[model samples]
Structures are given as C-alpha cells and as structure tokens.
Target: MGILVQEDKGLFHLQSAGMSYILQLVNDYPAHVYWGKKLRSGSNLEGLLNLGGNRGLDRLPQEYPQYGTGDFRTPAYQVRLEDGTRITELKYSGYRVVEGKPSLPGLPSVYVESAQEAQTLELTLKDDYAKLSVILRYTVFEHTNVITRSVEFTNAGETQLRLQRALSASVDFSSGDMDMIYLAGAWSREGNLTRRRLVQGGTTIGSRRGMSSHQLNPFAALVKPETDENHGEAYGFSLVYSGGFEAEAEVDSFGMTRFTMGLNSFDFAWLLEPGEQFQTPEVVMVYSSEGIGEMSRTYHRLYRTRLCRGLYRDKERPILVNNWEATYFNFDADKLESIAAEGAKLGIELFVLDDGWFGKRDADNSSLGDWVEDLRKLPGGLSDVAQRVNNLGLQFGLWFEPEMISPDSELYRKHPDWCLHVPGRRRSEARWQLVLDYTREDVRQYIYESLSRIFSTVPISYVKWDMNRCLTEIGSAELPSERQGETAHRYVLGLYELLERITSEFPHILFESCCSGGGRFDPGMLHYMPQTWTSDDTDAVERLKIQYGTSLVYPVSSIGAHVSAVPNHQVGRITPLSFRGDVAMSGNFGYELDLTKFTDEEKELVKEQVANYKQIRSLVQQGNLYRLQSPFEGNETAWMFVSDDQREALVYYFRVMAVPHPPRRSLKLNGLNPELDYILEASGEVYGGDRLMQAGLALPDIQQDFVSGCYKLKVQE
Candidate 1:
C-alpha cells in the first residue's frame, strides 16, 4: 500500500508498498534564516528526515525510493522506454471543460478533482529538469494531521530503480486576508488571479502565479512539479503551491479555487539511481468548524493515529497581546510593565514583550545576541515583571530577533568573522543589522543554548520570533567556496534545526515568525508556529483592503491581525474603533496598541470585542472562510460564512464609497439554503428568500451614517 497523507507536524506523510519515505512541509521566511529541527532543506522541500521509527534526519528527503518513480513523489502515471527506463510524466492536454466537460486540447486549462472525502491527481516531469520516469499520489480528503503512529517514514534503497523525478501540490488560493504575511517585494493581480514577486532580499528571483476557471471556484490548483531550477541536473529541490477554501467558499465572496488537475509543487520532484526506489508526496484534506464548517473536525479526530501527535484539545486558545507594534525599539521594563498591566486588565490571555528587551537594544540599530535581560533597561530584571504579569492573571511571552545581529552589538563585536559577508566586498545591512552566520556549528549552538536557558527560567507561554531584515551578501565564512553557493540553502537548514530544537524543548510555548511584516509568513514557516503575524500596518481601512489580498490563500485562524490606533501608526488613518474591531475579528484577533491610553469608551469597546470573539470565535476560526466582496475591487464588499447546519451565519459588509442616492444597489447573497425562509436581525426585515437576495437591500446614504455592518441571520427549519 503506497499512501501519503497530511500529518500533525505540519507535513503530509508518505508511505510505500513495502518501503518508507519522510515528507515534511515547512514555511520558510526565505529572507530570514530557517528555524529549528535536524532538518536538511532542498530547493523545494525541507525538514528533518524520519529515517527510523521516530528519529529525524539532518536534511530534507531528496527522493522517495519505495515507489517506481525514483523522485520523491509523482502522480498515478508512469513511463518506460524500450530499453526498460521508466518515465513518470504527463503532457498537459491544454484545455478543460468550462461548465462541466474536459478540454478542447490547446486552450491551456487546469483544475483539481476531489470528491467529498478525497482528492487525487497525476503528472509527468519530462520537461525543464533531467532524467524522468515518476509517479505521484495525493489523498484528497486527508490533509496535514496524520502521522504514524501518524508520521511518514523514510525509505533508503528498496528497489533496483534508475531515474530522478519531482512532484508536489498546493491548495491554490490567495493570502489577502492573512496578517503578518506580506509579498512586500513586487506583486500584481488580474481577474481572480494574483502573482507574488519572488525576490530573495531586494532583488527579484522569479514570480509564481495561477489562473483558474472563470465561473468555477475550486479550492486550489494541483499540478506536477515541473520547474527547471536552472542547473538542469533533473533536480527540483523546492516548490510551494496551494489549493483552496474547501470548507468555506463564501469567505472570499464565494469565488473559490476549489481544486486543480495535478499536485504540482516542489518536493514532488526527486532523483533515483542504481539500487533505489521511489515514493510520492502525501495528500490530506482539512475541514474545520468556525468559518467553514465542523463536520470534518468532529468526524476525524483520530485523523492519523499512527503518525500524528498532540492531544485533541480543540478549545479556544488564549487571548494574547504582542508589544512589537506598541513599542518597536524604544521600551524599557517600566514601559513594558505599564503595557503588561493594561493587558492584564483587559483579560488578555498572554503578554508578549517584543524586541528590544535583549542586548544593548536602545535603538533599532544594534545588539541581537545579548539574550540576557538588559539590566540597564530593566533594573527590576525581566523575571520580576514576568512574575507581576503572571500575578495579573495572564501568561507571559517574549520577543527575540535571534537570527540577526548588529554592528553595534556584543555578539558581532566578539566575532566580526561570524557575519555572512563576502571577503572584500561591502555587505548590505537592514535596520543597521546583519544576519548571524548560523551555518557555523558554534553559532547555532550558542543561539540554541541561550534560548533554552532563558526559557527554563521564565514562565513564558509564547515567543514572538521576529526577523526584521532579509538576507544580503549571502555567503558563509566557514564553508568552502565550492559549497559557498549552498550558503543560502544551508542557512535555511540551520534555521529549521534551531526551531526544531526550540519547539521540541518547549512543546507548550507558542512561536510566531514575523519578517518586518508578513514577508516571511508562508506555509514554509507555519510548520514551526501554527500562526503568523499578517502584517505591520494596522489601519482598519487599509487593513480591509490588505486583508482581502491575504485571505485568498490562508485561513482566518492563521492570520495575525490586531486593532491598532487612529492616524494608524504606519500610515496616518484614524478609523473608528468599531470598524477596526470588525475587520480584526476576521483573523486571530488581538490588539497591538498601548491599552493604557485608550479612553474609557474605547476600553468598553475592547471588552465588547473580547466578548464577541468568545461568542463567535468558533464560527470564525473553524468555519469555511468566504470572501463576498473584493475589498480591493468592489465599491462595496460583502461576504458571509454559514455553518453546515445553516442555523447561524456571519456576514461582513463594507461600503468603500457611498453612491449619491443610487437608483438601487443589487446584492446577491450566496451560501444560503435558498428554499428556507430567513430573517435579517439588524433591520428587523423579513422577505422571501429570492427577493432579499435578487432585489437586494437599499443601503442608506451610508457615507454619512453606516460604513459597515455585520448582519446576523437565522434560518427557520
């Protein structure tokens, strides 16, 4: 039995007829160094290899040998030459059915196929890279939460095979509503399609984009990993692709990327030679309760009993507050204490004192490694404040830009040779900081030991791991020039190892990855931390637009959105608190403002939001996420998500520009059980199902009165 399924440790598990293969999916902030684990990161795939029952590998698995494809994983198809060489490939037929038929042959068509409980596809990797012959597999409904006892294992050499190949799949959707994750480099969108400019630091590398059927909204695009990594060794070390919002189509205006034809991604490709076999990447389907629906969660609690870990405590997470936005680089312990005290009053579950708490960090310009408490900044010592915050009925968290160092710091001071710089050429520096050479065994050990030591002393429940700068002048001081080019790849491996060590040690601690704002936020990084900070700009108005872009791919629970101040700290925009809260409520809701300065009215508003979060959190976080209006494209945006039972629904509507007494604004509400009679609670309005949607609602002269409204609807059985 050859099978690949999503597992608990942020990856899909791969198995063969009689051999083993390890599959790990990681979200890397390519700009920042990769985080912990005994992982090896290839171009398109990364993470520790599960060579034995429970032991992890030092690098990502290159090829799965159990299968005949020779590559890590291919599709259901395979090929063999007259000379007995197997060729795992599929030539795209070029077109697909528009309403419900197959392609007309050269029209360039794509889509994924999935039933109620499973999704599967195939591919041919004969172009771009070298030696072919492969097979890929994906179980549609089984996604990211099964391991052996649920985890996938690695198979060294299981057959007399000869060939190399690649395979992968992405649930192709956009990340418009996601927070802290930014494509800040270069980006553009056309129709329901958008492309992110893939830049290393400040330079452009390549861009990846997707286009789907005009009328059919699938959750994602599943294609074969057919990219040529330029070297032409028949190697495709990496690729990250996606599918769609299978649970909630209405979250993004009901326009979904449902599924695609193939599982085309990075890890799917691999190399197999003499005495080797092959394995395919796993596939898993995800179902939730809050925004999309709950049928999947309640039904599949034991998704991967063999390979998956973590107790099934599907309860509400703690309400945490982060200080990254409140005080970027200028806050002492007293200042921190003030912030933490206010958080306690609001009943926030955790208090995270972000950057500047370590080293000689007075300005945004220096000292990364001085992990010890800054006595100069906090005369009371950090432990004292942690105790106080604990006394205030809140858990504590701290921030660290551990992967970086500054020219004005002690770590860099002691080892100028430790920075990743070219021998005689000047290196690029951001925020007056340089990245630490984690490739060195000594540097990796120091950072890991320091963090472990600090965590042992503090009762910190979370760690806001922020990487503010991207890599520049990439090269290592220790590695030979031959593998110097491997520096970028090696840096990522180092990062994964560090994070692996941290998380394994502090299994209870919550970790966050932030690169300035959302730059490093991706599925590659999500493996370590469950969620990411969506972005740094907190203006509600701007956020509505920004979040629209983020929500395309990510789920609401994964976005780090917060309610900040007016004349927003980033761009000066004073939006109403109500608007801010309504938008922020769309994601992992939190606040990044100085709570002490909030007026009593604002405080009351905060209390209300907290309550609202409690009431509808299950619906928002777990339900199928939908997008009703294009916050970016439409004049007025509206979208709603309904639970499977159809008893309750949450609809968010925003009027971007009010029309001057327009004749009539037609609103077509989707996701409704059209036959059932329903009532809109806010207006005390009752109308037949079709008319309420087709005839639409007459929005008042909203420019002066209502900007946005969340309507709750109840359906009569």
Candidate 2:
C-alpha cells in the first residue's frame, strides 16, 4: 500500500491493494521488473529482473524506451534537436517519493482528497547532450489496485527543441501470450467490446479524428486467454484524454510485449523553448488477478469517487426527460411546456430542452454559436420556458454546442477565421458545422461569456454540453507555422480550460457531456461533467450490448441511459415499454420521448417503472456490479447489483429474442454472502445465499421476444 525505494539494488516497488509494480535501474537505464500479484517487502526482487547476458537493449523491458536506441520498438518519446537530428539517449539521474498525487498542469487527472490516499514516485531521466530532462510520474492508490502514469518534458537547453513524439507512458511485459481487448464501434453503436489474440507484430487502436471518436475508445486491455468475468489475470490501460490518442501493443520477435499510450503523434509536434515544459495527460492502469470484473470494479470505484468532480459526484442523479427525440427542432415554448407537464405527472425529476432552442436553429445547420434564444420559437427567450418547466415541478436543463459554429451564424460570419482551418485550405464540415478554434483565448472567452449570460439569467439546473463534430483541417488560426501541428492537442487543452471555468462558476449545475452521443465519452470529460449520454442509440436491444460493454470501464452512475419512444428513434425497433424501462433503469434513469402521446395503460406502466427505479436507484448507482451473462454471447443478457453490506441485491435479466422450445434456465448470482438467507421479492420465495449463488434461481418461462425481468433480494429478517 506504499512505495518502497530499494536504492541499494536500484529497485523501486509500488504496491497497491492487490498488486505490485516493480522497476529497477539496470546499467543506468530504468527497466520494468514485474507487475502482477502483490509481493512482500524485502523479497529477492533483484533476481526478478532476469534479463539474460548479451543484454541487448531490444530485449530489455524498459520503463521508457527511446527511438534510435538499440530497443527500436515503439519509443515512449522522440525529440528533434536544434541540430536536426532525431537521436538521443537518456540515463537515470535521480528520483523522489511524494506523499500525494500531484495534478498535471492544464490537464484532467485522477485527484485525491487527502495526502494519505495515494503516493507518487517521480523518477528523473536526463539526456545531457540534448539538455532535455524527462520526469516520469507514477502514483499508486492506497486502497485500490490502480496506478496512474504521466510524463513531463523540460527543455533545459539554450535553444528550442521540437518534440516529434512524446507519449505519456509505456510498459514492457515479459510475455506476449495474451488476448487484446478494446472497445470499438461508431455513432449509435458505440462501445462494442472486441477481442483478438495478440499477434507477433504491432497492434494499434486510436482516434485521429480529433475528438475521441466513436469509432474507437481510448482504452485497451490485455488478458490471459482463460480470463473471463470472474477469474484469471487482466491488465487494463485507459487514457484520461479526449482528443486524438494512440494506443499500441507491439509484440517483438523475442516474445516481449511493449504497450504504449498517449497523445497521437500523427500531425503533432510541440516546440518547447528554453526552460519551457510540456506535460502529457495521465494514463490510468489497473491490474487484477481475479479477472476482468475485478479490474473493472477497481477502475469504477477509483473513477466514480476520484476522477469525476463537483456537486453531482456523490449525489443521486435526477430522473430526467429530454425533449430531443420527442420534438427535435419543431418544439416551441408551448410544446416544451406540455412535454414537461406530462413528465411531471410521471414523476420525472428533470426536463432537458436539447438542441434547436437558440438562434433560428430549426435545423442543425444554423445558429450553433449564437447562444440567444430564437424569438420565433420562444417569445420570451429561455427564461420563459425554463420558468414554465420549473412551474411544472421539474428541474430545467438546456443544451449547448459551444465548440462549434455554423457557417450561417452571426459568430462565424463576423469571424470566419475562428474555426480550425489552414489559410487557403478548404474547411471541411460535419453535421453542417465547423469546429471552433478553441486554441484562441478570444474564442473561448466569447463562448464563456455567452453561456455565462444565460446561466446567470435562466434558472438552469442542468446542461447537456454537446460537440457534434470532430476536427477536420487540424490547424489553428493563431498558432505559428512551427506550432501548427500542436492545434489538435491545443484545442483539447483550451476546451478543458473553458470547461473548468464554466463548471467551476456554476457548480450547482449538473453537466452531462455529449459528442453526438458517445463520441467523446472519455475520462477527461467526466472530470468536469459527472455523467455522459452513453449513446444516442436508445433502442433497448442495441443498448443491451452498448451499456454492457461500457460498464467494463465506466461506472453506472456516470452512464446516462434513457427510455425513448418505440419504434426507437435510432434503430426503429418497436420494443415493449416495460422492457425499455428495465434496461434504462440499470443506469441514471431518464426518458427521451413525448410523454403526452402515451396511452392510458402505458402511462400507468410508466408510473410504476418510475416508482420501481426510485426504490432501487441508490443500489443501482453505487452498488457493486456482477455480470452473469453477456448479450454478446447469445440471446440472453443478465447482470446484477449488490449492496456493500451484501444485504440487498437487484438483478436484471433480458431475453433479446425468444427461442422455440428452449431448455429451462436459472441465473447463478455473484457477490453474495454465502452464509445468509435471502427473500426474493418477485416470487416471495426464501432461499439461502449459498443456494442462490450455487443452485441459482429459475428464470421465468416467458415465450415472448424482447422480454425482461427485474428481481430484488433482501436478507431474510
């Protein structure tokens, strides 16, 4: 649970709750020794650095390898000197141990409330010829098997240096016999878990699309082939970054695997003047001996409590109903109020007026940067509608895409150079809008002032911050020629600054981030906004896989799930209302349909669904999740949440499509106190915890497609 420095043997051991990460300086080069199950202090760790004689740098497990060196795999960093050479070697200089984690300047990272929560090790390496000093930072949590790594580069030389590649962290594993698992999908179908065997070559997953594109997530995991939900070893690496990122696993001919992750070096170069420093975003690493589930739970707890901040960090999220899918751009004040009225009757706690509320935005092409309300739609502006919804006993929320500007908008017309584009280059647009040049302080200031005016005037309780497009031209108007490659990373940094200002100024507002749904759903955004619209695809069947795969890394509390109208807006799949409610309840419950159109029977069912979710919302949000079955495997999907005390449990089971003459099945639960007796609320049957976990409970024999069931278990009194 602390960092140990064995200077005599040049070994540094960082031990967390269930794992140990040991590294050593061999011949003045830091080399990875071991990272796995915990090892006792004073053990013979030196023998673990078993690099054989003929110690070629290529075969050594380096803590941070460099290019042009004998290693020659993927360098953690690369710098071009003033002499125009890309060759440099760094040697271990000094190191220090700190009591608490230090925040990365101008970046979002996992934070600590107290000094006792974690310990950080700062190891310094110096390329004396280039006068560049690299400080590698590693922090280990005292209570979780989580280690975060980041790197800081300082230009100590008299002349400027161009950094061609400066990745955050890298690790080398002795064995490449593992399976690579990553989340891959696009748009409505985000977070599809994909796995493959690690081959004897470079395997990479990343986003060159500016925002952490929905095409791929900034995460990857390596696991033993036998690893499943509950057993075997797994190592997870997730970048706390939102922009372009590259994660690679290179298996060398020697069977060693080198895993690296950081800002994508593609079209990226930072010019560091003398005495200037550049800090890379942190990469969170988790290790588990009890398989992928334990690794996920470790990340879940750490991220939920530490990474995400503000008023909503520990509070229960409101049951919100957003009007996007219900009315789109056709809604006026009257229509919005009517929707809010019906939502209030159904016990919805918040009403979100998503997109198309401002500046002639009847469609996505216009009025993106203009924050003023359209007089034609709302005669009295946002105040009128916010108050109207508030009168209906619902908290009011508004949507804004502050990072984009439409060509037809006043902001863009006044300052055409404000968007990301190279001079004389044709600007490309997506979703009928161009990405704002967030690298400029003036642009960020204007956006801040615009939103601040509304927040000050309106009674807004929530904000759905959306970015509908990715960076295309990848050039900032204000950056110099040498720094043009820095635009993509600078845009992300500027966005973080704006987000920090807005969220800090309005701490009471619950901020939910969206990038046309799950496109920018990464840890960096979660630091300012507590939750994210998991995906725009609200179809219960599609969400079964989306939410299940997302739960592998994100906590349930940070997932924004909603029950939309059927024929679901995205997929047009007509599913039962009850089934929709069952699936959406597993996350922060919400509705995304026109409630006024519901039938009388459907209204009653909606009321019951709301009530049921209210009774178990706390358990679902904060409880430990145990996945029993995966939708990826077959027709059935099952998962459950167990309270910390193990006295209360809520189980959800879904049958996507009914099978003809199916064999009887029972769900065996996990994370239960095996010695206790429990009462199943659904059937009024009492059973022993051991029996429920071992023998299992019989699933209902319903012969209907898209059918679902929810059960509550309470310890018998």
Whose lDDT is greatest here?
A: 2
Q: Which of the numbered candidates is closest to the native, going by highest TM-score?
A: 2
Residues 507-615 of candidate 1: C-alpha lDDT, one tens digit per residue: 8787766656565544435545656676677777667765665554445555677888777877776678887888888777888878888899888888888877777
Model 2 agreement with the true structure over 1-717: per-residue lDDT tens digits: 689998989999999877899999988999999999999988899899887786789988999999897987999999999999999899999999999999999999999999999999999999999999999999999888989999999999999999999899899999999999999999999999999899899999999999898999999999999999999999999999999999999999989899999999999899999999999999999999998988888888888999999989988899999999999999889999999999899898999999888888988889989999899999989999999999999999999999999998999999999999988989898888999999999999999999999999999999999988878988887988999989999999999999999999999999999998899999999999999999989999999999999999999999999999988778879999999999999999999999999999999999999988899999999999998999989999999999989999999999999899989999999889999999999788998999999999899799999999999999998
lDDT of model number 2: 0.93
Cα error of candidate 1 at position 397, Å: 1.7
TM-score of each: 0.64, 0.99
Number of colliding residue pairs in each model: 168, 0
lDDT of each: 0.50, 0.93
- Would you list the clashing residue pairs of candidate 2? none
lDDT of 1: 0.50
